[model samples]
Target chain A: GAGVSQSPSNKVTEKGKDVELRCDPISGHTALYWYRQSLGQGLEFLIYFQGNSAPDKSGLPSDRFSAERTGGSVSTLTIQRTQQEDSAVYLCASSILTGEGAFFGQGTRLTVV
Target chain B: AQSVAQPEDQVNVAEGNPLTVKCTYSVSGNPYLFWYVQYPNRGLQFLLKYITGDNLVKGSYGFEAEFNKSQTSFHLKKPSALVSDSALYFCAVSKGPGYSSASKIIFGSGTRLSIRP
Candidate 1:
């Protein structure tokens, strides 16, 4: 891909429903990251994946929030029993490697109604 | 812990005038600072970064930022503001590899820069 791509640019789901957001990072990028951005707020770290190493899931806000990256390429963020507080933009980024600048996706705006 | 603060919620600047967006950070060790810009309904774009070397780091779109260790600040600046520059700006900080895991990049609250005609 020319740049990071995210699916379902906008999503409106009822509370308690499950939603899945996808991200396709730039080709050949080794490091991928997931972040959440609320209205008028900063980017919140969610998770990170580096190559074949164990993913860093420390930033997931709660048990309902989970993510997985397959084959070190496409990634999915799944929210189970979503709450109103979960309404926000979910962003994904990829970098050439750790400690480098990251390229971001347009983001998926998930609205829990 | 590493964190960043962008005190101003909004900064108004006249076109062609110099513009500044303030940022401050707290970290356990040497800081790797970054600046990113976001337009309405779009993803954030990397502006510049301060990894090491010179305090003044230049980046795309004629923007630059100064990294000041003593003040614990890395303020984004531009000599002349353009109407197109009006957007949401964010400052982020991460601890150097030795201090913490590389995945954590703590972002500030963000500042909206508006360029007035």
Candidate 2:
């Protein structure tokens, strides 16, 4: 792909439902990341995955949130029992490698009704 | 843990005038600071970064930033502002080792910069 791509640009889910956001990082990128931006808030780091390494999940807001990257190419972020506070723009980014400038996707606007 | 703080939520500047957006950071290791601009309904675009060496670094759109280690600040500046420059600006810091090898970047709340003509 020419750039990072995210699926389901917008999602509206019930408060108790589970939602999965996906990211396809730029080809050859060794690093992928997920962040969330709540209304009027900043980009909150959620998770980071580097080639074949353990992902850093310290930034995940709660245990309800989890992510997995397979084949070092694509990733999926899952949020269980979504709450109203979960309404936010989920952003995905990929860098040539960690510590380099990262390119971002347009983002998926997740709204929990 | 590395974090960035964009002090002002909004900054207003007049066209052809100089503009500045303040940023401060806290990092455990070497600080890697960055600036990004987000246009309306668009994704963030990279502006510049400070990895090592020089205190002054220049970036896209005729913008520049000064890294002051003494102050732990990396302020974005432009000699002349343009209405097109109006956008949401963010400052970010890279989390060093002991965290993710991927070097996760922590972003600030963002400052809405409005350059009026």
Best by DockQ: 2
Deviation from native of the Cα of residue B28 in model 2, angstroms:
1.5
How well is each residue in B1-117 modelled by candidate 2, as lDDT tens digits?
688899999999999999999999998867778899999888989999887778899999999999998898999999999999999999999864345455778899999999888
Enumerate the candidates' DockQ scores in order: 0.67, 0.72
The TM-score values for the models, in the order shown, are 0.94, 0.95
lDDT of 1 by residue, B3-85 (tens): 89999999999999999999999988898889999999778999998888899999989999999999999999999999999
Off by over 4 Å in 1: B97-101
TM-score of chain B of 1: 0.95
| Candidate 2 segments exceeding 4 Å error | B95-100
Candidate 2 on A1-113: residue-level lDDT in tens?
99999998999999999999999999999899999998757899999998888998989999999999999999999999999999999999999855567899999999999
Worst 10-residue stretch by lDDT in candidate 2 chain B?
A: B95-104
RMSD per model, one decimal: 1.6, 1.8
CAPRI tier of model 2: medium
C-alpha positional error of residue A69 in candidate 1 after TM-score superposition, expressed in Å: 1.2
